[model samples]
Target: MSIGQSVSKHRFACVTAVCAIAAACGSFALGVGRSIWFDEGYTLIVESQPFARMMDLLKVDVHPPLYYLLLRMWISVFGSDVMALRAMS
Candidate 1:
């Protein structure tokens, strides 16, 4: 009820709001701007094939088929949305 108390409450509310906004923005930026590196690129390349082809390729390829198969299914469900792709990562 006092002026000083009101001012302190207002300042605290502003600081809390600003901090929440900043944390959200930072998470968004980190998720959106992150780049896929070599392993991710290779996963995409392998998973982009049809299942039969992917299986055949898996025979000769060195990496596990499970991850690539999961990626393929994920892409099938979500298409190429960057957020979905990043979530898979």
Candidate 2:
């Protein structure tokens, strides 16, 4: 292969690698920031409540009961780490 062709191939490879790395970085950043929201904090609090009593608290909350119910189920499937919990949200 000519030198020019080799150079072009190297440039393409570099661009592809950079794009992949950038996408991975962006996903990780979003994952890290996922736990930094008010609703997440509220979810954490509600999830800590006794299973039998959570329904009463949900009755008075601002959002729909469906979200709280889904969150409760999610927490059961995945243990309640803030990051893990937020990832499911």
Using TM-score as the measure, which candidate wins?
A: 2
lDDT for each of the candidates?
A: 0.79, 0.78
Model 2 segments beyond 4 Å from truth? 1-27, 33-36
Tens-digit lDDT track of model 2 for 12-78:
9999999999977776678774545787777888878887677778778877778777877887888
Clashes of each: 0, 0
- Candidate 1, clashing residue pairs? none
Root-mean-square deviation of Cα positions for candidate 2 versus the true structure, in angstroms: 6.9
- Tens digits of per-residue lDDT for model 1 on 1-89? 99999999999999999999997777667778667667667667777777798899899987778878788788889886566776676
RMSD to native, candidate 1 = 7.3
Candidate 2 positional error at 59, Å: 1.4
Q: Candidate 2's error at 33, in angstroms?
A: 7.3
Q: Mind sharing the TM-score for model 1?
A: 0.53
TM-score, prediction 2: 0.56
